[model samples]
Target: MADPLPTSLPQDTAPPPPGIGQLFLGFLSVAVVAFGGVLPIARRALVERHRWLTPDEFTELVGLAQFLPGPNIVNLSVIVGARFRGIPGALAAFLGLTAVPAVGVVLAGMVFSRYGDVTAVADMLAGLAAAAAGLVLAMAARMAEPLWRRPQAHAILIALLAFVGIVATPVSLPVLMLTLGPVSILLAWWAQRGRP
Candidate 1:
C-alpha cells in the first residue's frame, strides 16, 4: 500500500470564501498539481486546505458527481463552485479547471502527430500511459471509499446497474440519467423511510 498521507495538512493554509480569484486559483492549483493524480490533491485543497466543506460534505458532493454524466472533474467543478459561490462560481471553476488544460491538449494534439513517432517522445508517452492508469485507479478508490463507509447500498447498486446499462448500449447521457436518477432517488426514499 502507499505510505500514509501527511499526518497534519499544512497549518499555514487558510479557508477560502467566495471570490472569483480564490475560486479560480484554487481550481487552477489543483489542476496544475493534479499531474499524475488530481482527485486526491483536489479533494485535499478544497475540503482540507481551504476548509470550504467538511470532509464528509465533500465526499457527498463528490459522490453525486461521479454518478453524473460528464467528465468527473467537470462534475466536481460544478458542485464545488456552486457550493462556494453559486452558478457563476461553478462556471468560473469549470473554466479555470478546463480552459488551460483544453488549450494545452489542443496544442499537444496538434504537435503529437508530428512528434509522436520520435522514440524519446514515444517513450515519454508510454510512461504517461501507465501513470494515467494509476491516476484513474486512485480516483476510483477515492470515490469508492466514502460510499463503502456510508454504505449507500442502493445508490451503489443503482450506479453499478447504470454502469452496466451504459456499457450494454450506446445510450446518451440524458437518457442514462432519465433511466437511473429517478430509480435511485426512489430507492433512496424507500431506504430513508425504512430507517428510524
Candidate 2:
C-alpha cells in the first residue's frame, strides 16, 4: 500500500487571499487580543479562524521568521503580507500589527512610571508576566502539533535533537543551526523529490 502521509506537508485548498482591509483588520484583532505574546493568537487567527494558512504553513513561516532579524511575529506579519498582496499589504499588516500595540505600550509606560511603586500595580504586572509565560508554553505545544502529526519520524527526531541540544547541552543557537539546518532542508527536499 502507498504511504498514507503525503511526502510533504499537506496543503489544504485555501480561500482567496485577504484584501488589504482584511489583512489590516485580521492583524488588528490579533494585536488587540494578545497582550504580552501574539503567536498563539496569530496562529488561531490565521489557521483556525481565517483559514488563511494551514497549520504546517504557519509553522514553516514562523520558523523562517525566527531565523530573520527583528521580532518573530513582526517578521511573520510582513512575510504574510508580502506573500499575499506585495508591498502595500506588508505595510498594512505591519501597521495594523504595531499601531495599537505601540500606542498601548507608550501609554502603559507612562501609567506604570506613575503607579509603578504601588503595591497593586506591581502585583498586576507580576500576574501579567505569569500569564505571558503560560501563553508561551501553550504556543510551543501548538507549534509542535504539526510535527507530531507528520508520518516521517525524522522530523520528530530532528526536533528532539534540536531541543536537547539547546536546552540540555551547551551548544549555541548559531552552532546548532549551522549543524542541523542544512540536514533539515535536505531531508525535506528528499522527502518530496518523488512528488510530481
Candidate 3:
C-alpha cells in the first residue's frame, strides 16, 4: 500500500489573490501608520493580517526588493500588485502606498517651517525619532527570527560580517554587496550540491 498523505496539507495552501481595492486599502493603511518605516507594517498587514503572503514568502520578497534600487517596501508593493492584478494593480498599490504619505509629509513640512523654533515641536520630533528607532530594531529582530530558528553558521557569519562592515567600519553598501553577494551565492550552491 502507498504511504499516507500528510494531514497538514491544507495549511500549505496559498491564499486567494486580493482585489485591486483590497490592495489599495491594505497599502494605504500600512503607509498611514508607518511613521519611520513601512516594511514592518507592510509585513504585518500582508502576511499576518491579510494572509496574502507567508512569512518565508514575505522574506523572499523583501530580499528581492533589497536587491533592487528603489525603496524596498515600494518595490515590494509593485511586485505584489503586479503579481496579483498586473500593471493596474501595481499602480493602485504604489499610489495608495505613497499618496497620503506624500501629502502628510508636505503638510508636516509646512508646519515645521512655521514652528521650526518651537521647543515643544522639537521635543515631539525627538520622541518620534526615538520611537522610530525602536520600531526599526523590533523589525530587525522579527526578520531575524527565521534565520535564528534555522541556525546556519555561515549565514549568521555573513550577516554579522555585513553588519559590522556597514555599521562599524567605513565600508560602503555597494562595496559590501559586491563582495558578499557572490560569496553568499557560492556558499549556498556549495551547501546544496550534495543534497538530493
The residue-by-residue lDDT of candidate 2 on 18-104, one tens digit each, is: 999999999999999998789999999999999999889999999888777689999999999998999999989999999999999
Overall lDDT per candidate, in order of appearance:
0.79, 0.90, 0.87
The digit string of per-residue lDDT tens for model 3 on 57-149 reads: 888788778777788889999998998999989998998899999999999999999998999999999999998898888888888887888
Cα lDDT for residue 95, candidate 3: 89
Ranking by lDDT: 2, 3, 1
Q: List the residue pairs that clash in candidate 3.
A: none
C-alpha TM-score for every candidate: 0.74, 0.85, 0.88
Winner of 1 and 3 under lDDT? 3
Candidate 1 TM-score, C-alpha based: 0.74
- For this target, which candidate reaches the highest TM-score against the unseen true structure? 3
Best by lDDT: 2
lDDT of 1 by residue, 1-196 (tens): 9998888757656454758767888888888767666678788887767787766777677767866878777898888888778988998888888877888789899899788889999999889889988977776677566667778789689868877877787887678877687888899899999999
Query: Model 3 — which ten-residue stretch has the worst lDDT?
Result: 7-16
lDDT of 1: 0.79
List the lowest-lDDT window of 10 residues for candidate 2: 5-14
Winner on lDDT (1 vs 2): 2
